[model samples]
Target: MPRERHGTPPVGSRPMMSIDGLGDLWDTLFGAQTDPPALLVLITGAVALVVVSTRLPWRIARNAITIAHEGGHALVALLTGRKLHGIRLHSDTSGLTLSAGRPTGPGMILTLLAGYVAPPLVGLAGAWLLGGNRITLLLWVAVALLLAMLVMIRNVFGVVSLLITGALVFAVSWYATPQVQAAFAYAGVWFLLLGGVRPVVELQRLRSRGRMPASDADQLAGLTPFPPLFWVGVFALVNLAALLAGALLLAGPFLTDAGLTL
Candidate 1:
């Protein structure tokens, strides 16, 4: 017979807090737990942060959104069989995604559109995971995305930004208490959900003044019969729909309690 286990198990068998055990901790912290009020507060706070950031031009607060934007283009380009050349991030909250492909084709059109749509789509996915109390999954997913972008970073700022962003997500996922991870994940999801809409409005304003040429909206207009203004409207509509859907998903428990679920 094997010896009786002592106060602690063997090294490999011990209940260690490794990456493999992240699920266990996440479950312990948020599994099957629904705190609607806290979730709402976090989402509201995230929206406020983005609103304030919009007022402050060229702030570091906006870089994360820019990274997500450019990364979106790069990702779609690769997915559509385009060769990604590089990505560059600027301090002015602008970014460029370089890829080798037909200049005017379906691939180009999709790559152009991906930047504006990525944030809200990512936020919606995050909200879905949060609704199921999958906080660890959210953090790890963020880390994976940041890392993927990091490999495509072709500029100093891009590399630095991606590294810092990846490190934060990794730190939160690997070391932070589960409650803290959950809170951060909620804030991040809300920020992405809300941050996507303002840019579409700004793009329209720029286009009206003839300042934005060759923008994603303008490129979309060239590809489709719809005008640039119409494409902007479509982007706005998508972001708004994502926002509303994310909010409802995040608040599902509360809505169910209020007999509002359909």
Candidate 2:
């Protein structure tokens, strides 16, 4: 029998975190309200999502986060002189990835970092590309939603994800102005960073489950445990700084003219 977890929350029946009608009601409730600052609310909401995501009982339910982690392993394998095998994904709580080539210390570590943080940055980029005007934002959001529908019809979640990314762009577009798009962009970077580190906590859960997902390096070269702590700490600090710099680039847009003069 699968061992029960210490503090695992009751798993939700929904495949994804159903926002219910929250997204639809945004313009009416929070959008209509003043001075709590819609952007602050956005930031708060974004942070809350990340926190909630970490607490999720199943990786399948939080596929994006799992993908990010597995992607990191693939990246680390590539850098360390290896190849990706393929992905194993699920609806909310579980995943097991197969990869060829194991990361030699340095490469494996970086790949780990990659999976942790890539998603939110992807969100930020989406926001940036959508542009900040309201009509454009709404239009793009519609486009993404329609595209996501086509993806659903095709029975391809990845395709659905691709089309839905326009929604990320919509996030920045819906904000007060183009000037703050960077903030949203940075916000994505921050989301990625948080997601990446989340697995540290997940590590404990994995230990109890008696499974360690092999990365590209582990598959290709054979399983060797994740490197020692000092290296991991060094890995953490370096990635943290890199992500911060990335966030700055996002935040910088508000401060810089960045070609908006018409």
lDDT of 2 by residue, 54-104 (tens): 544224325555544544454445566655554444444344434444333
Q: Candidate 2: where are CA atoms >4 Å away?
A: 1-61, 75-83, 101-187, 204-228, 231-235, 253-262
lDDT of 1: 0.77
50-116 per-residue lDDT for model 1 (tens digits):
5636676326667877887888898888898888878888768888888887776798788888888
> Which residue pairs clash in candidate 1?
none
What are the lDDT scores of the predictions, listed in order?
A: 0.77, 0.43
RMSD of each: 10.5, 13.4
Ten-residue region with minimum lDDT total, candidate 2? 28-37
- Clash statistics: count for each candidate: 0, 27
- Provide the TM-score for each candidate, comma-separated: 0.82, 0.44
lDDT of 2: 0.43
